[model samples]
Target: MTLEQARAALAAARRVAVLTGAGVSAESGIPTFRNAQTGHWARFRPEDLASPEAYRRDPKMVWEWYAGRYRNVTHAQPNEGHHLLAWLERDKGDGFFLATQNVDGLHARAGSERLVELHGNLSTARCEACGTVAPLPEPNTFTPPPTCPVCGARMRPNIVWFGEFLPELALEAATRAFEKADVALIVGTSGQVYPAAGLALETRRAGGVVIEVNPDETELTPYMSYSVRDVASRGLAALMGEG
Candidate 1:
């Protein structure tokens, strides 16, 4: 499809679904977890700090790692890419749905409410006993392993560790949106990770317009209706007719 066709699809479509990934976060200066590691953390692999087995082995260590990450994200500012999606959400309202592989909470800070964190986020703690999720304490005052306010049980970082399923409700909502969308915007993803990839495929199967925005062609590039070869901020700006 031509660039005009891509823009027309976005402008005319009533229901839109968006999927975002690490490249979006990177634009805001938030490094991927592996890349964020430094000093003592640099020695460990991602699985060492992010797996259920690792948390079970030493919950403190895992929580501490996440605590550092929480601090990192809180210190960073949301970029134009984040704000544009949030603005798009305002225009689309209930017709919009956003699902992100990122866990930094930048989208939330940028004013997106109709969204889900596919991989969970670092801004909160989940009650191990009661399942209540609560925001973490202020960065400077927080210590590792916050306790649950609801149950007084030990609260773990509100993250989906390896070997865990994405929250069922979140996954189902994102899937439904993709399946029914008229346009699906996939931004900054490698397209290697499933079910994020699966969402794009769902859009394809439903005969929806699938637009991918990335600097390089991705695994799903072959399936896209069109691709914008640029970074998230520029690509999304172009899509919104603001570039």
Candidate 2:
């Protein structure tokens, strides 16, 4: 469908569900996890740094790596794509639900209220033993292998590690949104990740219209009713009649 058609569909739809990925934040200069710099983190694969085994073996190294990422995301501002979604939520009210695979807090910073963060946020830290969670400490300084003051157990960034399950609440929320949506707008994701990728299919299976916005064809392309091969920020803006 054309941009005009998409806009009309969006304007007329009662329930819309949106899913985003790293490509959305890439516009804001946040490096994708797989694209870490060759000099510093290239030596250590993301899988190595983002696993329970790695944290168990060398928590300090994992902490240091995540600390750098946290700092980067804290410094980067949300881009047009984030603001566009926020605006959609503000104008469309409860009919719109957004779920993101990005760990950066860009969607929150952009003022998206009804959002589901499937990958978990990078701005929070949690105690491993007691499950006490808190915003990352000030001065952002953590003694390598940080310890929780509340329980004296190790502190780790509250993210879903490689081998970890996606947060149950987030998964449930996204699934519910998918099941209820009349239109599902999937953006920026390659649609390769399990569960998140499964959303597009779920929506289609439930008889919802699926619209995909990305710069390239994704695994969801075949299932989409409309595939717009363009930058997400631009495509979404156009689709929302803001361009």
Candidate 3:
């Protein structure tokens, strides 16, 4: 569909749900977990550093890796796509809900209030033992594994690690949004990831329209009512009539 058509659809929809992925943050210079700079340990697959077993076997390594990620994310600013989503949320009043698999916290930074961070966030730390949550200390000087001040338990980045479940509350919210939305805008995702990818199907099953924006055709393209081959920043701005 043309940009005008997409905008019209968005404007007419009563309830809209958005699902975003790493590509949405890439425009802001955030390196995805799979594409870290060469020669850095982060260049290794995220699965190697993001798992309960990994933290249990070598807590220091896990903490250092997450610290590096937190530093990188902190240095990056939210891109235009993030602002567009936030603007849509504000302008749409109660009709918009955003669910993202990225842990960068860019959505919140961009002022999107009704958002679910499905993968948790790197800006917070959680106690593995007591389930206590707190903002991670600034500068993250702890070597290797960090200790939680409240419970003296090992503090892990609040993100969902490999083999771990997504936060139940966030998942439930996302599911409800998908089930009730009249339009579902999927941006910047490969549509191969579980749960997040399933949202499009849920929307479709609920008789909602699916609009997908990606640089390439993802697995969900066949299921989309509208498909735009563009980055989220460009596509979403166009859809919101700001382009």
Residues 99-162, candidate 1: write the lDDT tens digits.
9999999999999999999999899989989999999999999987899898799998899987
Between candidates 1 and 3, name the one with more favorable lDDT: 1
Sorted on TM-score, highest at the top, how do the candidates line up?
Answer: 1, 2, 3
Winner of 1 and 2 under lDDT: 1
List pairs with backbone clashes in candidate 2: none
Tell me the TM-score of model 2: 0.94
Over 101-145, each residue of candidate 2 has an lDDT whose tens digit, in order, gives 999989999999899888888888888899887777653564445
Could you tell me the TM-score of candidate 1? 0.98
Candidate 2 lowest-lDDT run of ten: 137-146
- lDDT comparing candidate 1 with the true structure: 0.93
Which has the better lDDT: candidate 2, or candidate 3?
Answer: 3
lDDT over C-alpha atoms for residue 153 of model 1: 96
lDDT of 3 by residue, 1-243 (tens): 665777788889989999999989999998888776346683566677888888788877777788888888888999999999998898777889999999999999999999999888988888888988777767545353567777898777898989999989988899899989988999999888878668998999999888998989989899998988899998887687645
The clash count of every prediction, one per candidate, is: 0, 0, 2
> What are the RMSDs of all candidates, in order?
0.9, 1.6, 1.8
TM per candidate = 0.98, 0.94, 0.93
**lDDT of candidate 2 vs native?**
0.85
